[model samples]
Target: MDESLRAFLEALDYDGEPFGMFYTDQEPPSGFAPKPGPALSMELEQSGAINWQEVWGSFSCVIGSIWLARKKNTAAYFEAARYGCMGGSFYLGFHQPQLDFITHYVSTGIPGTQVHGERYLRSPETVRRFFTEIAPRPAPKRFCVFKPLSQFAPGETPETVTFFGRAEVLSGLVFLASFVTDDFEAVMSPFGAGCSYLTSWPLHYLGQGRLKAVLGGFDPSERKFLKTDEMTFTVPYEMYGRFLERWPDSYLRTDTWQGVRKKIARSRDAWGEQAGQGDGKD
Candidate 1:
């Protein structure tokens, strides 16, 4: 539950459903490393006037539909995946400055089913369609929002964080990063589980460049609560164990959100830049 994301939603007037959540920038008194982020106080500058939105997989059409796979509703899944791929997943051909990005949680509605996994995997085509289709070529919105929430903050409390957006959906970000440098491996899985799906098409075939994924997984028991359509996103544990052993100071940088936001906002210049709109404009 990244506070910036929560604040961004409220600022965006997502007040209809009034989704409620309890969050603390600090972990519980018990022994848990919390998620991988920095301290909340260091997370953002808290300009108080800053405005941003966490628009991960809000392409509801493709999303909620994936849950229908269990109902033999692959059509709904494909439709949703198509829209999300062409829409939510990519940010190309824009003139905005780089924007913000980070792993965060949202208490989004669940459609129910396992195809959410498929949707996550097959997202690029639709992601690029938006840049190719929909137009007037709207100006990119201001405010860069990223996530990975810990417990701590004024008016923030404790509650289980439900990961709303699916995983690996941000492969677009990974692909875009390839254009600038070879740090693509910075986000790849050690076992290569996602590499093929990651590089299956031109979406990621940037010709040259790579990133190192500090990727790791958790154990099933460590998973708080997961239903039939749910997955714990676990790993062998040994991989991350090495990460902690080597760099004992990377527990989710709450403090880095603002900086991360600015960076993505800058990168937007290359991906989602809107030629005439000024970054400072409303």
Candidate 2:
């Protein structure tokens, strides 16, 4: 992380430093990799019910692993062969045209059967259309790593920077994301998993060379992994750099932000977070 950027966010009383997403061949240190899981496709094909235990061992959501990444200040990565879930494999760019069962799984399951649906959407067709519209891409490398920005090595560049924060912190970031751009849609909230908002959608904008920020963490299924007040904001890494450079000239330094800062302090108190706490409470 740039020292100046760190100072700026600290001044804003942002809870933690933003983390970065990048691709590398290197595996994460032992114990940081997600618990080994069975192939989702095979499990669904054979049992009609997911063995959540074998699928993720101790944690189910990929976002939980990400929270661990931020909390421990270490890298956690996903590979094509070992990505934790079907949704993760798709959103993290390991696969496309995700498992065939996804269409039914997200909506209504097979009629009169034990394959109950999550019912996230009205119908299979709607879920199919959602996937078609988002159009996830394949990853550029074998390993997709999420590391705290401060831990990035020399010459390492992240594809995107993601922040997990409450509404107040996100408000400042949202404005900064748009402060330097004139585009009407500088920030977007799309429908998808928490993991998708953190990586896939931001990568989608990066691929288009657009400096859009993604607001996510609305996925009910993954909410259990996050703090009660947390949501996510992700921008292309280049755009994050622009935020760092322009924030000094933006509204962050003004008295108005000071009011927000007070609110941040109050929130920290309510959440039992202390000032100068390590990174954040995630």
Worst 10 residues of 2 by lDDT: 52-61
Question: Top TM-score: which candidate number?
Answer: 2
User: Can you write out model 2's per-residue Cα lDDT over 1-282, one digit (the tens) per residue?
Assistant: 578877877766776678888888777564256655665553365476756556546344678778777677787788866787778888887767766577888899878877798999999899989887787777888898888888888888898888888889889988888886756689999889889998888777777777799999899988877787788899888788788778888888899999998998888888888865634554
As a whole number from 0 to 100, the lDDT of residue 135 in candidate 2 is 78
Q: Write the per-residue lDDT of candidate 1 for residues 1-282, one digit (tens) a residue.
A: 454444433322221111112212232332211111211111242443322221223323222232222122122211111222222222211221111211111111124632222232233443233223322112123211111233234554312111221122122223322323334333433221111111111122222232222222221221222122222121112222232232223312234434444543454443444422211111
By summed lDDT, the worst window of 10 consecutive residues in model 1 runs over 98-107
Could you tell me how far off, in angstroms, the CA of residue 253 lies in candidate 1 after the best superposition?
A: 24
Q: Please report, in order, the local distance difference test score of every candidate based on alpha carbons.
A: 0.25, 0.79
**Per-model C-alpha RMSD:** 22.2, 3.0
